[model samples]
Target: MDLDLKCKTPILSYSDDEFKQILEIRGKTLEQLPEDVNIIKEWLKMQPHLPMHPTDRQIVCFLIMNKFSIERTKEKIDANYTIKGLMPELFSKSPLHPDVQKTISLVSCGFMPKLNKKLNRVYVCRLESTDVVLLDGYNYFCSFLEMKTICDFSDSDEYIFDFSYFPMKMVTKFNPMDFKRVLTLVEKVYSNRIAGLHYVNIPSYAEAMINLIISFLKPKIRERVRIHKSLETLGEFFEKDQIPKEFGGTGISLSEICDNMNVLSKEYDEYIKESNNARVDESLRPTKLINDDFLGYHGNFKKLQVD
Candidate 1:
């Protein structure tokens, strides 16, 4: 597998020193990987009839997530396509309907425009309203995948979940299956991208909500989850200027960030549309579907203790 380093846009920007640090962690150099373009070419050679050629940045994301292990990267690439094919509702096409957009907007999630000194991007989410009925899990998941496309530049990501205004009623509305599906994709397909997850102003009763979500993560990732009693505590992990004003930081407000993401999401519309066609043909695949396949899991939501 050849690496294609030529990205049309800066997916993740790193200084020369930071780039070296990343390579050292992976035990490889840019020269060894070259450009990730070759990696996509090799994948095409193997599959021969994939619906679309993944962008170089997307290929780099798989490579970085897999620690530059060619074999592991190949497996993730295949699984990525396979999952997208299986879960078109979440992976293919952006949701542009007015109602769908309104539902997603109500979720109050957006990526911060700034990166930390380490260059890890920050994702901020909050529930500004108590109308849980207004939130659509499928649309939320789709928006997440859309946001994930722009997060490819950095190998690590930091998440801040602000639950200051979280409604207790919203807890029961949580869809465990949708939650599990998102984690499944993150763990199986977008592995090793999350560096840290911080929960701020968490209500005491919301511990159950956190526990339910954490149960889906691996041990290492579970360990990365932190609950903070105050914004000051979160400030220890990130600079004040790096944080958004909505969170008591000096940066722009969450509303502004969401507005910017709205524009950026539109730009990804075509890519998402094309992604719908990138499904895997099961008959042509060398492996048979198993219970552990992307969409194989099925059970009662009651089993997840959502009630």
Candidate 2:
């Protein structure tokens, strides 16, 4: 099947300076990492079962993630494909069933239509229901991951996680194992893509929850996670006019943005299904055992250190 890897979402309009900066990064990456394309081609040659033909943008994403270090890029590329292959339930394509749709509707997560002043795409996530477990939060979370394929354009994307309505009970429902999966995907696969993660309207107990999540993250990523006391504090990173009205900004509502995303999700369903073929086939791989431990944690969640 011919996979359409084209970004379906409207590309963020960058300022002259931002555009120039992007070009400089891309040019430098190409110069420093000239063998990047050939590296992927050679890797693909080994994985006969994997049906992916990565685009220039996709290859560049890994390059930028590793700061143009060819060795690190190759390592990341290998880990990324391996994880996708191993965890088909999480990474593979499945129909966006009604249950998934219901979860998505409850958990409003999507990229804001507009870019911040720094030309970074802002991603907004809010949980409307405190019964996160019943909401099938894992699959709901996966929907945002799927959306990122099309929405993630800039080298650095800003994240706004609204926890105003999130209660302590709901926080407990979040499985540490699932949290580990998210961190692994972001750190290992989607590295350097996140500019900053702003947690606004944080509940008093949210700090503990935040700490638990950050413990799974790398130091660099942990540093980027900022807790905002109010929307005013968040405004330091994003303009008030650009923010959605739900978050005390003058822009559109979160529901409206999510509505748009829902439409896009339906349209891109085919692409998501086709992309599953891109996962590496470990059976055919020469390297039989890569470090499959995504977060390096084992045993029951209760035993895991949350503090």
Candidate 3:
């Protein structure tokens, strides 16, 4: 029987009263129809193998009325039910095709159809060794996947403390006042350390708070502010990511340090208004003003000469 397994077998034609109603209704042995599937592995192949093609039986009966088990395919044939009977009203109205929402997030555990943005709904659940069920009840995707798996095991040492000194350790951990308050304290320290500060001794406390805010802004810009050659050229360009956040630029030349701190705060407010007008013209001098009769002329006008 080896003419390549008799030309890869699949040739049944039967019709003698449909093989006598399949040998009087019960006993069956026809087989060979399974192989079709390919509309990109029946919608993106992440563990597909179900009964599949008969034009994907209304998407495998809307993934078995959204329960998602799959692996039958013997050929029962007969259940169009228009889009599997409007899949509970098409997932309760709208947004499916991201390959039928990742085949309803790979049949339920490795779930991904999110869109919850405050209950807008596509129902979120299933990703923890997945079993494929989330049609609307995995309690907000297993409490946001166990809060992102305990925030990825508490930031497994903060992305190895290297986001090019994440905007200079978030503008020296909020020592903000300008440079647009250090870019709003680097967007609230990278959105609260990528949402819930896990850990890795926070990049040596973000490299000693960005080396104390770039050595306190190079000694307030050089009045003998010897910042050891601008903190060793911004600590070797913040350890080689090339600086710019306004001279400390990681997000590069951060608006030239807010235009050099608004042109050095308008030249330190015109040098404190010309040093308070030269200390009021060297402590200004003034003479006394005479009053009344001038004390009847000093010693009676040198003894009675009526001047």
Best by lDDT: 1
lDDT of 1 at 128: 71
Q: In model 1, where do residues sit more than 4 Å from their true spots?
A: 1-20, 35-40, 132-151, 286-307
Off by over 4 Å in 3: 1-26, 31-78, 82-133, 136-307
- In candidate 1, list every pair of residues with a backbone clash: 3-35, 3-36, 4-35, 4-36, 4-37, 5-35, 5-36, 11-153, 12-153
Q: Give a tens-digit lDDT track for model 3, residues 1-307.
A: 1101111111111233432232233232223112223332343333222222333433322222222223222111111111122122212211122333343333222211111111111111112223322333222222222222111111101111123223332433343232322222122111111111111122444555535434443232223212222323433312222323333423223333233323332333333222112211112212221211211232232232211
Provide the lDDT at 282 for model 1. Answer: 59
Of 1 and 2, the candidate ahead on lDDT is 1
Measured against the true structure, the TM-scores of the candidates, in listed sequence, are 0.82, 0.78, 0.14
Task: Please provide, for model 2 over 1-307, each residue's C-alpha lDDT reduced to its tens digit, 9 standing for 90 to 100.
Answer: 2323234455233444553455476566224443665676676677664456556556655666566667677666665555555445565433366666666767777777756766677878888976444335554455455445443445567789888788788767867776776556666665647778888887877678778777777687788889888777777778885688988888778888877776776776666666644655545656444333442232222233322
lDDT of each: 0.66, 0.63, 0.24
Model 1 worst lDDT window (10 residues): 298-307
Report how far off residue 80 is in candidate 2 (Å): 2.9
